[model samples]
Target: MGEVTGEVIVITSGKGGVGKTTTTANIGTGLAKLGKRVVLVDTDIGLRNLDVVLGLENRIVYNVVDVVEGTCKLKQALIKDKRAEGLCLLPAAQTRDKSAVTPEQMAEVAKELKAEFDYVIMDSPAGIEQGFKNAIAGADRGIIVTTPEMSAVRDADRIIGLLEANEMQDLKLVVNRIRSDMVERGDMMSAEDVVEVLGINLIGVVPDDEKIVIATNNGEPLAGDESLAGQAYINICHRILGEDVPYLDLRKKKGFLAKLFGKN
Candidate 1:
């Protein structure tokens, strides 16, 4: 048989507070739930939180630093997910700076990981700094996460440009925390607007929901839930697997005349 290879995707954002880590945790868990051996790597280095989001913080004995420093094997540093069978996490070191590991080292580690797992999701640090470079060191693809706001959309555009500069050609967008009510009122940017601005393939559109925070507070991803945002993540997982999944109805009804027709 031919040599097996898997996807190495870096999930990132240009600015902070765009729910990048949360999206990574959910998507990683969702992919594993679909029976794809998935590993979520926290490349946030000094500000590691993917472990906490996945509820694997208390179980970490070795980290990415250890793996890169040759103190431990990659298998030794991987902390498997509690809920998902095949999901695991290689958490970042909270004390080490971004300079602790070189891009070459990260790329080597990712190469080994992609050989064993079906997907390697890197939770990139916010900003276009060294941490960002390290996060995308070996990524074959990139997913930019942003909100339905002007600033977020702007930052996402910048991140997309950086990803292209890095030669990561397979780039996509995931618009999160979209408030349909506000979009309908013309107060929030719709998914179509963000896509038009960024000019990238739209992969996922996650709605704003309280369940996401609740799931994070409980140290779990909102993957198995039935909430709108949770279901959105599930659909995203399917799309990642090359499935032709259509987006759900996120728009609300206007007046009867507008509803019966197609426009207001």
Candidate 2:
């Protein structure tokens, strides 16, 4: 593939606690690290958490709802990241619900942002309700995040089906929190197994790392680090830029340590 121009992509996971916000924050930061102008928008109204993931929760004065409601200009709602100079965030409203905005409004906002940035990343809320519809309305593609567990995979499958039904042809998968040792010991699903079940193009496979928790607590993104999960996020960002990267080998070893520890 050639160098990708500006593209709008929604990072969505049908179920909650599947690392959707973290995927958004890290991928945005990773693209910014490559010197690309990226804008991350939070579409999880009322239960907004993207701001916290990016460590800009306190900086959000205006939000996406504000822009859609004409309460503030689009530029006024953007919070620039301190670390990634080329990255910005459009936070979600803490007081609003899914009813506060419509799909057309989201498409308009995305269309507006696409004029200036090289990438527009939307962090979608869980479920297949109006919120999901609103989040995916204006996107050129999607990055579906899921864990190795059956529940997350099931939800991801449903999300993929919905995207396909909407004719969103560029949907990709990101298997987050992969337990490498577990896969080796036949405990968890391998990346190949996930691809087999989803039957979709794979973009990334991020390992479950303690550093992610640490980074979250520090309000920093793991994309800046070279941890197992961090590298995966960075690679996915490159792939979004149309770069081809071989999938990382997460199931390389299985020994006593693997048996001593529990599988994720």
Candidate 3:
């Protein structure tokens, strides 16, 4: 509604398959649901999927590389989300690699998008390479998404170091795909364990839910939905907006946990 000078936030994971793109889609949609203008930039060039996750892949006539290379206007490359009113997507060029756009060019794009939207969320590619660099180039803040695994936590720590080295200190963490039963059985790490290892402020913890797979397959973000994972993302949005929302209790029901892990 009101004019907003957007804040560019990069959603990154040093390791792939940790739901970084999913987090971007949901957070952008969540912000839109909160009446904020949100744009999701897919910076994972050559392997772009944010558009797919948001179901805007078919509508993408131009890509972020086009905007950087002057092949199209910034607005022309942005595909609007059909479900969320104020949500848009600046998809990456599928045919081109990360080298197609430099960090400076990505920063310029972020600037242009921020001038119009309330929040510009960039979905960074996996690994600490040029794509990751470009993703964080225009970001005012960063959120690292990881699963409750040692490998994911290790990568997240590396990402945090890189982000802080870039002088972007406002970082947050989201632990995804948390299986409470596994944690109860000591078969998997807990969200608290991941946080203690990464040493960052935890923004949200998403339980392992089949609904996430369904939503991804359906090209819909479950941010505002009633599912546990969806509510977790909504809580993340509220925390991003400076609300002191408490984290979700991801512990399984007593009966379910007892049945699955033989715990009381």
lDDT of each: 0.90, 0.91, 0.92
- Give the lDDT ranking, best first: 3, 2, 1
Single out the weakest 10-residue window by summed lDDT for candidate 1. 248-257
Better of 1 and 2 by lDDT: 2
Tell me the tens digit of each residue's lDDT in model 2 across 1-264: 234447899999999998999999999999999999999999999999988888998888999999999999999999999889999999999898999999999999998898878999999999999999999999999999999889999999999999999999998999999888788789999878999999998999998888899999999998957677788888998898799998877654457787679583
TM-scores of the models, in the order given = 0.93, 0.92, 0.94
* Prediction 2 global C-alpha lDDT: 0.91
C-alpha RMSD by candidate, in order: 3.5, 4.2, 2.6
> 221-245 in candidate 1: lDDT tens per residue?
9875778888899888998898989
Name model 3 segments beyond 4 Å from true.
1-4, 253-264
CA lDDT of 121 in candidate 3? Answer: 95
Q: Please provide, for model 3 over 1-264, each residue's C-alpha lDDT reduced to its tens digit, 9 standing for 90 to 100.
A: 246588999999899999999999999999999989999999999998998889887888999999999999988988888789999999999999999999999999999899999899999999999999999999999999999888888899899999999999899999999998899899998888888888898999999899999998999999989998889999999999999998888875568656888855
Candidate number of the best lDDT: 3
Candidate 1 regions with alpha-carbon error over 4 angstroms? 251-264
